[model samples]
Target chain A: MSGPTVLLTDAAPAKAASTRRSALLGGGGRALLGLLLPLLLAGAWEIAVASGFATGRLLPPPSRIGAALWSLAASGELWTHVAATLIRVGLGFAFGAGAGILFGALTATLPPLRWLLDPSLQALRAVPSLAWVPLFILWFGILETPKVALIAVGVFFPVYVGVAGAIASVDRKLVEVGRIFRLSPLALARRILLPAVLPATLTALRTGLGLGFLFVVAAELMGASEGLGYLLVDGQQFSKPDQILAAIISFAVVGKLADTALVTLTSPLVRWQDTARETL
Target chain B: MLSLQSLSKTYADGTRALEAIDLAVPNAEIVALIGGSGCGKTTLLRLVAGLDRPSAGRIALDGEPITGPHPGVGLVFQEPRLLPWLDVAANVGFGVSDLPRRERAERVAHALERVGLAEHAGRWPRELSGGQQQRVSIARAFVANPRVLLLDEPFSALDAFTRKDLHRHLLALWEEVRPTVLIVTHDVSEAVALADRAIVMRPKPGRLDESVALPLRRPRDPAAPASEAATRTILGALDRSLRPRDAARTPELAGGSSF
Candidate 1:
């Protein structure tokens, strides 16, 4: 069970070298592992439809879904829908997260501000995501404003909660370090408060983004004229199962890519975090 | 010189942590504050470091009043408290950011070298062991060249070997900068090894019971006859400090008895 010291020393560098090399290749390999289940299911459905085991009317085959997506892309209809969805999410996230961070910072640092706003905000947060859709439409009317507002509402609460909660839990010991260093208030916020809240802030942003995607679907389903949500509505009205499935797949793909982009962009900021996530 | 004139701290919750602590520490002297729990040793250090305000009286450093955290005063906490976002060099160079870029880099390099963490300058605080992190914290305080440095049980968490090893690094750094130190420690051996004068305190509105001046020279051995004698003397002061109020009379004030 035990290796000699000489043998252990000889094996260590070679093992380390191989593991280092595997790390680069392992990411793609891991991604492929994630695709395995979906691909298997698609393949099984394709064979089932091809063999005429069941009518592919209500539940379309993978081939029919791909064809529907391909035709939409060939005419550039897919890009229009994708762009519309992306614009709505981008605008909503930017507005919501900006206000969230600003208000969160204010409430956390000033006791009076916290006392004034925290209770009302907490009450507003109890309102469900979909429950606000009708109210937002009534407030902003049947236009882009309502859709964007809906998505913004979805993004705001999580970011606000994350920022406030993170600030609340920042280590007082670290703040005392700032005090001992004689950091000015601005310097204290810059050096301690900002970096300390970053990991949780990033998590909140990601969660808010996910909720934005959810609300974007809800927003588009109601009155969107040209979006993936619209495509869902169109397919349902026309009774085209393949087109609906294509829109669903597009949503999954675009949402996942957007999430990956977010993660990639913010990854460097929290590289210092010694999380258990790194152990894997 | 650092002077505390009748310094007292009564918490808002009605606990008088320290009562009328008056002391003057000359330049470059190391004073170890030793006592049992609730002795307000840490509170006294905190008040001196200016991290907290004393309810009564004031502190002066070189005739300058210290109302808050002063640039001339530094503190080492129980934990390292190094900024996790910063590397070892950056953390050590934190208080000295006002220096020119070249000078900051040079000073950080020098401080890292002093702590024997020169090679690990680029490593994050998380990568270092408890002892190494504490050493970086020590370097951080010393690199600023403060006139007074306060350490609140900075080595209580370390293993005995690491603790002894750190004492050497601390002394080496202390030799260079010669900051007046007020270290709060429970270890009698630590006080004996580092402190030029060990001060004992009694709890319940902590007051100074006695101050034992050590006559040992530089690089004193904890096991040496003079060091052991000093340790035993300070220990005697500590024992008498915890006794009932009337019985805490200094019966062996002039003696340095050894077993």
Candidate 2:
């Protein structure tokens, strides 16, 4: 009995190790598959341009787009535009998200404050960000303020709703637990409310950032001399298809990277919740 | 000591949960309130814990009227109710915020050690099994060192093996800390196995029916004749309380009722 039990135990870990190794290989294979379609498309585009089936001026080849990107990088124009957009997005996101969280906390916790400000905020939220653009440009006179404010307005509503709703729906039983332990109001907010609403709030922030990117493009299209949006307009004016494609590609890559960064930064805080969901 | 006098509770919609319930628990005594569902055992416990206010009556702790959540009272709910974000040590230390940092850590450690969960102190609540989470809740309650501890069916959710183990653990803790304990449970054997006195309650107005004193020694074997006898006595009282209502509904069956 002892010998057979020892053999079975030894066999179990070896089986587990093989399954883990296969899982890693499986992930890598899927990633390679994801790249296949894009590479094939690029190849087809290059072939079409080379064969003169598709004109280079209308739909630029992948090589032309690559050359355009290289020229921009060499001139240092790419870095300045990218940096400007990043700074605007960063500043606007901080301002809008900070105010959203504060207002959400107040409205969710206090009935009087909710009654006073919630309706007005809801009404304002219904107004489109574009509708604010002309008014913003008039009020702020094409300065950085109107552009930044547009992005902030775009980022504000989702975060506000997420935080307020999350706080409102916190488990009553857990709040009772806090009360039973004689937790002060501030202590309860810090320990219970904040942790409970964190996952939802982070999701809202991700969505808000995506919207921020869209608004930045719209803002830059108005009167901006720099940023990726300017490049798109400039390319359109000059009929440079390569430059337009480059701008669009940069947007996709940067948006993806920002979302990935947010997830990586917040994953540790929500690991317990994720594990609970998985087990369930 | 904990005392309740003529405690009654009627909901806003006119559902009477408990009526004129009177009881006195001496300090360091272990008492169990046993009843079927809707028998006001939990209502009584909640009133004592000051989680709900009595419609008409008073509860006092050592002659002081209980108003809100009192510092000397601790409660363990049916579910563990441990915060998922906090690890075991943090949950255990939750109620000891008034203490200095070092003292709070020591208290949390001591409580976890008592429940045999010191090794799991760094793990999240989700990482632990159901029994372990309940133990963390117990550790949380005991860490505060309250004068009166109220448990509302704390072990009814566990499996038999785990429930038996927790019963022993609870008794051992009671022996050490010696807080006045009021446990509300529906399990008759649990009542007989743990409490020095069991208060049997009945539904339809939810009043106390009888109190059975268990003279069995500590470290009781539930299968022992004495423990079995106590269980039978409490079950018999519950049966009697339940019989009259059934008899009233069906007159024909009441004539030959064996119960």
TM-score (chain B only), all candidates: 0.95, 0.93
**Model 1, A82: alpha-carbon shift in Å?**
0.3
- Candidate 2 docks at the CAPRI level of medium
Q: DockQ numbers for every candidate?
A: 0.85, 0.66
**Against the true structure, whose TM-score is highest?**
1
Task: Give residue A263's lDDT in candidate 1 (0 to 100).
Answer: 82
- Among residues 3 or more apart in sequence or in different chains, the pairs in candidate 2 whose N, CA or C atoms overlap within 3 Å are none
Residues A66-174, candidate 2, lDDT per residue (tens digit)?
9999999899998887888887888788888888888887899899999999999999999987999989988999968998998998898888998899999999999
Per-residue alpha-carbon lDDT of candidate 1 for residues A99-158, written as tens digits (9 for 90 to 100): 888888889889999999999999989998789888888899878999998888889999
lDDT of 1 by residue, B214-253 (tens): 8688788877888888877888878877778775454332
Task: Quote the lDDT for A154 in model 1.
Answer: 86
Report how far off residue B61 is in candidate 2 (Å).
Answer: 1.1
